[model samples]
Target: MDCYKKSNIEDLKAKNSYKIDLLDYSLFITFFPQLIAGPIVHHKEMMPQFHSLLNKEKALINWEFMAKGLFIFSIGLFKKVFIADSFAAWANAGFTLAQNGGTLNIFEAWVTSLSYTFQLYFDFSGYCDMAIGLALFFGIVLPINFNSPYKALNIADFWRRWHITLGRFLKDYLYIPLGGNRVSKIINLRNLFIVAFLSGVWHGAGWGFVIWGSLHAIAMVSHRIYSFLAIGKSFLNSKIYKIFAWLLTFNFLNIAWVFFRSENLSGAINILKAMFGITWVELPYKFKASWLFREIGGNDKMVGFILISFIICLCFRNSIQMLDNFKPNIKNSIIIMLFLYIALIMIGVTPYTEFIYFNF
Candidate 1:
């Protein structure tokens, strides 16, 4: 909070408004629902809203938006519980075993990586959807959280799309403050490293996260170098480039998750070693359903649920678009009924997991 307040003050000072009380930003930070998980609301976006809230009449509950919010929230809950929780188990197990220097094949490593990736996406995005839905019920338009980031063509574009608010916040508050791209070459390098280090720390209190942030900064800087040399632009516009970018982005994110998931620096090192096939010992048993239950983080049912849920999430945007355009006829009724049935099944079968973003 102090760092953020200092940053805010520095921003103000730059504009010759150093007289502003630092405590004035408290409301921006302490908005109850968003204090933990944030589509990190910026001072520029939030300050005006806070002033408006002061003069505002009591917010009326609009039943229509409330109902819609409930419906969306229900779906998000199901996704987090039924799907994301399942994958969380698998990812956790794989990570644990890998840390112990137990045997891990390429298939297992990649599957675990993919599972962690989807688990994060579902866990975070589900919460975001619920927050946005609830905000809409209260006549607020909360910012979008996750777009189809997997579809981005480059790392630069990927940052813009994924965790849109964080990227914007860092750009406005940290990056630009450190001279952005306008300073001397040496200063720019220093600022980039500083912002990335801060970004890592912002995510959590660990050096592993710091390394993860540094990796991303290095990637960004590398991309800039390539751009300056006019190397990848035309090629990057090609389909092959898009494919490579997607692969790179996903794998980069997956590797970072090892750091995010690990207990400490040594744990991160162990996981990274396993990822590189450095483990020399074999586990006592093979990867069977029963063995998975005994040794892994979660059950077969949970794994199945997560895999299926991920498939649905991958197609969710299309599903929502269909819902918006489809006419209210017999087909619609049948679809709604099916959805309701699935929701009920989820409620019965799934074990709940708190949304991952809650930590942030």
Candidate 2:
């Protein structure tokens, strides 16, 4: 509402000074492609484009743009249908096992957390890609939302990469309005906490969500303090130090995901207990020989998949990067079409699964 009001006021001020059509203004607010899960378009960015005569003409019959949009959309569909949905079952099973009085062993705990981590990432990022691609088909360029967030070495860096539009909205509408860094350090910390807490609550209704948000808040505050003290400056500059920092940030994110995925506070605590080796059980030989072996085998596959995803996220170019350097060639088109074919087949076989961010 605040963002809307601010934009509305600015638009009215501009209208009084210069001529602008109402249809363009309406389209700027109701742009269909980005309406579902936003890259949060701003009026200034969108309004000018609506007035572009060249863009309007090009959008009607741009074969090159259409091909690029299709390619990007195919990748997103593959990510959501083939990869994210594959992990959903494993994640659900792990969490359900814990809730059903089954002991959540260390392996199960990690598997559940990791599955959900990848699931959420691919699911949300996939949607973002599709939205951006759709917008491009209409000659509209929405802001990039995901930028290989798993590669981030610190919590602060993670926020910058992940759900970038939402972060921008919060920074502009909440943090800045709350005095931001213009105030004393203590007040700045207060603003951070409030924003984080609201962010958590905005995700869902639960104490686990609050705790997840609080965990991030605490991490951000600690990072700020560390920066102020200039602690371990030399270490921070080293490659080895960056690897350690990435590990720490990634693990912290996984831990918070446990809370986010859990049904309740106790459910989250139980998973955390299993993760930390505070829960244990001994199964009979027959049971261990049969079900335990199968479970371990499944977990091994999941671990392999997670590691592959991590590599892709950390070492390879993201969708946006690929799109930027894209060249439409026969070989590339064939590969993309093949992937899209597989994704369509998978979609046929799998039951429909909603993107994780829909609830938010």
Q: Which stretches of model 1 miss by more than 4 angstroms?
A: 1-31, 43-59, 232-234, 281-348
Minimal lDDT window, size 10, model 2: 1-10
Q: Judge candidate 1 at residue 110 and give its lDDT.
A: 55
Over the stretch 1-360, how does candidate 1's per-residue lDDT look in tens digits? 121233543543354323335565765566655557876665654554344445473345555445545555555565566567768878878777766655555445656666777788777766766665566466444555566665555567667767877887888888998899899876877777777667778888777777878887787777666666757557767988767777777678778877877666665676566567775435336676555344454446655665675456444562223323545356655655565577668667766656776675
TM of each candidate vs. truth:
0.75, 0.88
Q: State, as a TM-score between 0 and 1, how close model 2 is to the true structure.
A: 0.88
lDDT of each: 0.63, 0.78
Measured over all alpha carbons after superposition, the RMSD of each candidate to the real structure, in angstroms, is: 6.8, 5.0
lDDT of 2 at 238: 93
Model 1 TM-score, 2 decimals: 0.75
